[model samples]
Target: MSITAQLTDSVKLPNGAELVNGFAFEGRGDAARRALFHNGHELEVYDLYEVFSGERAPAVVFPVPWTGWDRGVDSVSPDATFAVFSGQRAVRAVGSDGKQLWEYRHGCWGPELGHPHTGDEQEVCRGLEHGSCRVSDDGRLVWAHVVHGADEYDWQEYWVVLDARDGHELARLPLGSAASGSHHVSHPDGLHMGLCIGMGQDGILLHWARWDGKSLTSWDVNEGLDRILMDVHNGLEGFLTVEHDGADLRLHALDGAVLAEGEPESGDDENPAGWDHCGGFVDTETIIASTVDSEEEPDRARHWILDARTLRVRGGISYPTGPIASYARPLGDGTWLTYDTRNGTLDRWTTATP
Candidate 1:
């Protein structure tokens, strides 16, 4: 069961736009098709199809207050009307017109504590520690992770949900763990959000939460296992995860049952190759993953197409356009993306023969 990969389109990033997440695509198909590019202070919203055709003009743009290095992760609303930034000190919502819509303050992610010197941006500038923010599918809520002052002397990590319209705090749950940074993976159900918190050498923590309009409920998943939650299956049947060390890849049901597991042979009897955290479900029944971390040279790295239902390796993706970067991101639309760092261009790929 082998599938071939072919390059379809390549678009150079517009006007020196340096992106944090490269490009964040919204939905699978044309019904709700959009992509967001954020580079610290500005966010540009583009139509996914237009981007494929080398369209350079963004449909909308939002200007943020803090610089890129001072922030954790930022996201834009599905409607492209508001952009939320998770900064070292607070979560801010900015409008498309470059105005501050609202802000929710929290304990600083930086080490500076206790005393209020001056509310200067440089106070927490260049801090390595941070959190992540994501807009809900409905555009009614904002899910965020932040450092909170439990009291004057103690600070705790908390996951909070905010009213997107006004930045009002609606619900919160204390994470009870140290975090270096985290990312939110939104479930297709719109009510559920999966959070993966990176705890550095302490390993990884994965949490799942649901916002059911009235209340927020959360549960810790992958307990005792150091797995990094990667992506939710497009059908919402199960999600993808790879071990923190990339030793094993697993697919789990919504209730946290491991449906399948895969440990690719590294060709070394002792050291098995592991999948990197860079891939995802390419479609309903297929997965595209990478093993770049296991390769000493980036040029020698390889990407594999796996059976989404069973985690079985099907074959390697053949690039007709020569070599791709070590990482490939599956867009869940039967296509994936790779970046050419040399020319700052993004190349889109799909199967040359189906």
Candidate 2:
């Protein structure tokens, strides 16, 4: 017996707006995700559904001061009062009225900005593509990475908690992280936030933080290992799912204890490329993964479902529409999302007993 996702829904984007992760920002409670369009001089956000359904005009449209394209929107507050934008040397909080609430400005995107990993006299800018900011589950705080002491020859990296109503730095923890850039995910617990930094060949860095009412505390789970932090399973408290060396998929506690591990099967007619990444989790117990090894489009993908708590294969999944990327997204419900970047559509799917 095997489990495979059956397509349930597909939503296309408005023209000019590419489908990017977190670009279509939506919270668990939100009725729809806000679709953003940033073309340098102007930044506009259409109610992802309002425009798609022809129910209303763009929810919010504003003129932007910057000319460079923003990588993506970091986060939209749960209350929909504000949105955060991130990119090279810029992190800004904008109000629902399309006015600047507050801004955090820094030097070039990376490197000569005194970044420990890439700072060189000649190195100029290193832009980030991730919308790395996250709002707490309670909607009281926003967690972000702000460049600290950036002017000195070597700058510091600080993960911070911000005032959601007004852009104010509340508390921060110093992480001597030397990565090219990073992305973030929220924990089920409102006060906890997780980070994954990519450093190319140097490997990945995983940082987890908890913002108590008074202060903030954080620690690294990398353990000097060469692995990439992949997904955060809020359903399983304190356990952060990760990918080691881009192959070994494992579940780890915040303290760096390995709870479960999944090894890539050798490539054959059954599993492609000797083994590939797992899809992390489906609900709290079901974890799905793909055997297709290529990051680029795979003509076909074979999925394996595993017991999230035991790291044992429970079943296999197959794609009817075609191959999906190694990453299969769990929708928190019984369903998950599958995508092909080349096709530019996010397909909602679910497991079917076959």
TM-score for each candidate, following the candidate numbering: 0.91, 0.79
RMSD of each: 2.7, 5.1
Candidates in order have lDDT scores of 0.78, 0.60
Alpha-carbon shift of residue 221 in model 1 (angstroms): 0.9
Kindly list the per-residue Cα lDDT of model 2 for residues 1-354, writing each as its tens digit: 556568766655334224333234344222354555664566566664354354445666555534544453466666566777664555677776778888765444444443453533333355542325666767788777656545546567767778776758888777666556666776765667777766666677778888788877888887777665545554575453546434566778777788877765535565434334334556677776666544544554467777778767776676676555545655455566555566555566777655
Candidate 2 Cα outliers beyond 4 Å, as residue runs: 14-65, 111-131, 150-152, 266-278, 322-327, 340-344
Deviation of model 1 at 122, angstroms:
5.5
Query: Candidate 1, which segments miss by more than 4 Å at Cα?
Result: 14-23, 29-33, 113-115, 150-153, 294-296
Most accurate candidate by TM-score: 1
lDDT of 2 at 107: 42
Give the per-residue lDDT of model 1 (tens digit) for 1-354.
Answer: 445778887888743223213336566533345677664567777876777776778889888677645447788888788889888788999988888999999987765444663668646543578899999988999999998873335889999999999999999999867888898888887778888899899999998998787888888875688998888755757899999888889999876789999876454655456677777888888888887562245665678888899899888877876656547877787887777677888777888776
- How far is 250's C-alpha from truth in model 2 (Å)? 1.2
